[model samples]
Target chain A: MAQSADAKAYNAKVYVTLRPSVLDPAGTAVRSGLSHMGYDNVSKVRIGKYIEVELTAESEVAAKSQLDKICDQLLANPVIENYRIEILEAVAV
Target chain B: MAQSADAKAYNAKVYVTLRPSVLDPAGTAVRSGLSHMGYDNVSKVRIGKYIEVELTAESEVAAKSQLDKICDQLLANPVIENYRIEILEAVAV
Candidate 1:
């Protein structure tokens, strides 16, 4: 990958999951559904959100900083959810 | 980790995303929102699903097979969405 003098476009993959202590009704429902569908071996289920964001940043460090703020402020609810962000290498845009 | 003679409990992570050709109105909306919130460097956004499931199967191969069917039948819509499943190491249950 070639570097530009200015900003580069980076793709970030963010995964947001609920805290272990929080109850997930939706996951419980899905687990029940699977059990009824004859997948009785299923024991637990948890649902979360996956987001991909493409942004321009001056450097990889800048991209990560921006993504961290974005995840905390927008991509996840800090009260009950935790988020993990992975920023892919710069891509031509 | 030691496995039981009959079945071992496997942890699986499933990621479901829309096909590249599909229109993602929600992601678009989020991008716009980010732009409005002073994150003008943001270029694109795509939203998807992340799921974790625990189930018992005779082997890792069987766990993957069962997950494939579950994703096809219930977790993802084949026409518009694509899914990737990863089975983590077995855990005692």
Candidate 2:
């Protein structure tokens, strides 16, 4: 039997946080919920989303452009939040 | 009235994790660094990355396709980690 080929590999990390001046209703709600859930020791509660993606792209440039679009157009709120991206590695699939 | 109009708004969240079997040297180093930094109370420290992007798109479908390409191609490691995407909102730019 012959071996099949693999897809390209890449890694991206994204972080989201509420803007300094904007009130974070969601965070406040989570904290309150935690307190009600019996987690009395929980001093602070900030809720954020985390996503991981796997893809095959022709080059790093194309990959980055696509990643940036996702962050700006779908995954983050610019009005009240700030974010950053990190590239972990580029490896063969 | 002077209004130049706004650009479309989108948000994304990306999470990266080491494959269960692969040793996380980077994470280990950070944990060790924290211990040396006099934060001995910190335990089981895990490190990850986050990104925020802004863009303009014609429609939601196009936006989704672009976002998926970003995840599968750039933002995630398929071998060791799994990822998910969230769309916060679609507003006029």
Largest TM-score belongs to which candidate? 1
- lDDT tens digits, residue span A1-93, model 2: 111364345665556666668775665664465456543322333445443444344455655665566567655777776766665555775
lDDT, candidate 2, B1-93, per-residue tens: 112244345554444555657676665664465456543322333344433333344444554665565556555567766555555544555
Quote model 2's TM-score: 0.41
lDDT of 1 by residue, B1-93 (tens): 223577877899999999999999999998998888889888889999999999888888988998999999999999999999999867665
Could you say which candidate leads in DockQ?
1
lDDT of 2: 0.51
- For candidate 1 chain B, which ten residues in a row score worst on lDDT? B1-10
Query: TM per model?
Result: 0.92, 0.41
Instruction: Please give the range of 10 consecutive residues that has the lowest summed lDDT in model 1 chain A.
Output: A1-10
Interface DockQ of each model: 0.56, 0.03
The best candidate in terms of lDDT: 1
